[model samples]
Target: MPTITKSNIDYDKRNLSDKALLKLYYNMLKPRLIEEKMLILLRQGKISKWFSGIGQEAISVGVTMALKPSEYILPMHRNLGVFTTREIPLHRLFCQWQGKASGFTKGRDRSFHFGTQDYNIVGMISHLGPQLGVADGIALANLLKKNGQVTAVFTGEGGTSEGDFHEALNVASVWQLPVIFCIENNGYGLSTPTNEQYHCKHLADRGKGYGMDSFILDGNNIIETYSKVKKLAESIRKRPRPILIEFKTFRRRGHEEASGTKYVPQELMSEWEAKDPIENFRSYLFSKKILSAEIEDQYTSEIKAEIDAALDSAYAEENIIPNETIELNDVYKQFEYQDIKPNSNVKELRLIDAISEGLRQSMEKHKDLVIMGQDIAEYGGVFKITEGFVEQFGKGRVRNTPICESAIVEVGMGLSIAGMKSVVEMQFSDFVTSGFNPIVNYLAKSHYRWEQNADVVVRMPCGAGVAAGPFHSQTNEAWFTKTPGLKVVYPAFPYDAKGLLATAINDPNPVLFFEHKALYRSIRQDVPTDYFTLPFGQAALLTEGESVSIITYGAGVHWALEVLENNSDISADLIDLRTLQPLDKEAIINSVKKTGKAIILQEDSLFGGIASDISAMLMEECFEHLDAPVKRVASMETPIPFIGQLEDQYLAKGKFESALRDLLSY
Candidate 1:
């Protein structure tokens, strides 16, 4: 329970023991030399590219040593020293850079974009700042479990400018999570200097606004860096709270091997060179007599020899056949249905009520389930979908969040990684654009990238009819369906909404669940009270006919049904595609083959929409059986107008009947 302060241990005194000092020194040395070796390989054309962490070894080594190896770390590209300190086999590291089959990601990714489940380290993507929020999620998970584990996340000074950085800090501060947000302030964001990047003097000062404990440390000084980080890490583990530390460091090499340092002034480069992190550490160790010149020379030779051997071994390995693992991690790796007793007496419920019931039942079933969104708890969201949720499930379980879209998904990814099922509400589907990076880049590809299942259900209330206008009325299911790894479900009726949401929450991967705003109060159906799950990638045959196959989902299903009801002559087969990504291609093909005609309808834009993909698929499969070309009826390529009459005109109101009539006649 003791805290480290200047009053107790002298600032100049050697805090770490001789053995610990040597370990820290070696941690810094190994990655510095490994980078040099990689640069050599880059020049020799053995590796495609390299991002050298030449002068930033102190921060990486210092932080890694501060935390226990059991704790999780979300490291950026430059933190190769983290891998080395964890004693990741040198061959595995080399194999990753060599793009060999034996690598962590099996040659799927390059540089430090690989993670080993055994080490509890999740490697970063090219999009740098989102990991901070993911780290916050991991920390939140630990706090919830009372595990006393902390998460250390790394980013550059440039990354602080990103919205994810601020969002993550705010969440960590509000929730009092055990996370350390380490910023490596090397004075430049790739090419842009610090002055142009932010008006604030110090990056660490930004954390004060979030009410987090912030510090500025000399990144080149090993003793100072180690002492401060070690204390902060210890304190946060006991009393969970975020700590922001800005390490004033330098990257001695180019951003990449090909990018020269011509943009930087000669004086700046020379100044950083003289105060090199690794060299400065060596001088400190020599001053303490922990490492002599003789030992240093012997150690360098040994490290160089080890790296060379590892590179040689990596080069000898075969390249991974990318096609062999092409199908792997594309969607939920595996899924299983929950056994529930079917209700003999079904109860009729509205779409919104059914969704809330599904959430309540899911939370009751799984203790690790957590609900997160803006106004979702007290106000029951903008639509009261989660009405009375907080009373049933305590505020801790049914939580309200700050208006942070990107962090919402990013935090969900982290919580999912830490074995928590997160049900996130986006208030409105149109606002999903604000938080699209984590969903598209991080959450969608998580399973594929690292076999990390983001057990997250992102509830998006979508579509028009309520006259919410451009920002609120947009149906963005097509955007997510286009993404490979995410399972997109846009249900029409109350039964499908309840069942699909349950299935989505219990599924092993990330799912984007879209509920039409118009259907919330309009539709009512007999939904089973007992826990029931609907399978993904399957379509519901609402009304079967022979003339044409009407394929649609969400609000489009109702529109198609209305057309079918009004016209008795035209017998159309109404098919609702419940799931989008794992699309029911067989059903569509069968329907088109039987009817000899097809119509793909949706509320999204005409160009580059879900109908487009369906049309392409139908053409490939049922092209020979079709009597005429496929017809797609969708909203025009313009913003949804604020005026109801104008919106109807833009949507081509009552056009589905005409489109179907034309297709049937052809």
Candidate 2:
């Protein structure tokens, strides 16, 4: 706990080769000079913006040196120095800052989020804390590969406040994933200082709540930072697990390219300014006689010249993506969203059977597809959706993951990032309530932030039937669709599940596939053997008669189908909206226009049902198309009851048929 001002290297225990020490000391300066070079660019107006990681170079450089190219490092935007150590070319780094495609990761990624696939660094996420989720996932993938790889995620003190940070730590601890959450506490989160943000004093203390080994390190001391992380990393390699390190340091510069650090206390800045990690490390090297004055000056001068030359070259390079790079390698093409082709000759299939079959075919079609969940392999899931899947596909293909819900989601997401198509099953759809973090933060927003796509499909069992009370059953599609980056689907029949699951797997986004456990075995129908596909936004007009159009999907689709069959003359078109985000609003409006009336239905409680969103949309787009006020049929606003009879009443108890009858009276 001593304040890390300066420390001498112990040559006795680890005889320092002057050459090795020179390299380490040299690396420390390269990243520093790069930061200073960035400031020159900022001043010259060559670079519109940049952030400088001046004080924290010791830890970032030390950690970068410890890497094995196969290990993943989630770096912060400010840590531009670490990118070079990971073998990211200096000119490319400069080009990225100057808005050129020649930059580290091409123009697709922000200059700050430069990633090198060659160094096994999965792309950097510019957003704050969520990279820890990706880090946990990367560790999970490395463990699965038995590749002795590690993922070190760098975040700031402000990141600990995000839900993703807590959720990631919890999962990494449970699964013992080889992830290290490095917190660079430089006092402020874009001007809101950490001291003013939280009651939890040290960021490291937050990890203990999730049962992780929390380490507080003096980020400015290379000797301490390197030695401590060396052992921690060794322990992780032995048997991967998550760790949190709080690097108590302060920023020498501002947050980002245009940050105004005027509010920073001058005294506080002066206190940390003297112990600048690079300068301290240089002094330590000189004290040990490891670097002669001539060599020290020579290396510093050479490094500064190299940085200046790289920046100059980067400034002169063209900013546009090269014609060759437009489709270069296309190894990234290995991972993509599969669009479900709309089928004109598609037949009906059972939801579970269709989904399971789709899983099998997807595994057959794509070598990278991995299916996992509690009881999914041998038992074919709780609903027997995956029954006999383990026998047909090997254990690795249809995996029986441990009972760690968040880990399952994160591991699957991690695999997806590593160019794999992963299908994760929820034992009961209710279990999805536990793993929402990775879904929303890492999976959902990945495409938007970095144009990074994850083809991870989650088969969520939803709705209430067969007496699955509160804990066993629930419809939470509303929770998913509320987020803009996710694709939510609730297939009423097996055929829709088959087609939509195929679409979901092919989709360039995170898809929440809701398959009602109640309807899994309750009904059976003729499913297609060949030529199968379903349009996401296209709604099915079941027994269309035209007094009212009822929009619903999933279990409610069954009820609407039944109502259509029972009262054919009453004439209500049942529109099964397979895709929620794309929503097929055009179809709904057309149905409402033809029928001149509308009703939306859902199995979730009426209070926060998706029907509300639809009702609001209809009022905005199609108020004139309505013959009567748009209506909604949803479960009553109560937690599902224990009694089967009560559950039926609590849920949508033939409510659609009655609503249809009332609408026909319109």
Best by lDDT: 1
Task: Report the C-alpha lDDT of model 2 over 330-395, residue by residue, as the tens digit.
Answer: 212233434545445545566667777777777777766778888787777777877887887777
Candidate 1 residues lying further than 4 Å off, grouped into runs, are: 1-11, 328-331, 337-341
Model 1 reaches what TM-score against the true structure?
0.96
**Each model's lDDT:** 0.85, 0.74
Question: Per-residue lDDT for 77-109 in model 1, tens only?
Answer: 888989998889899888887778677766667
For candidate 2, the lDDT comes to: 0.74
Give the Cα RMSD of candidate 2: 6.2
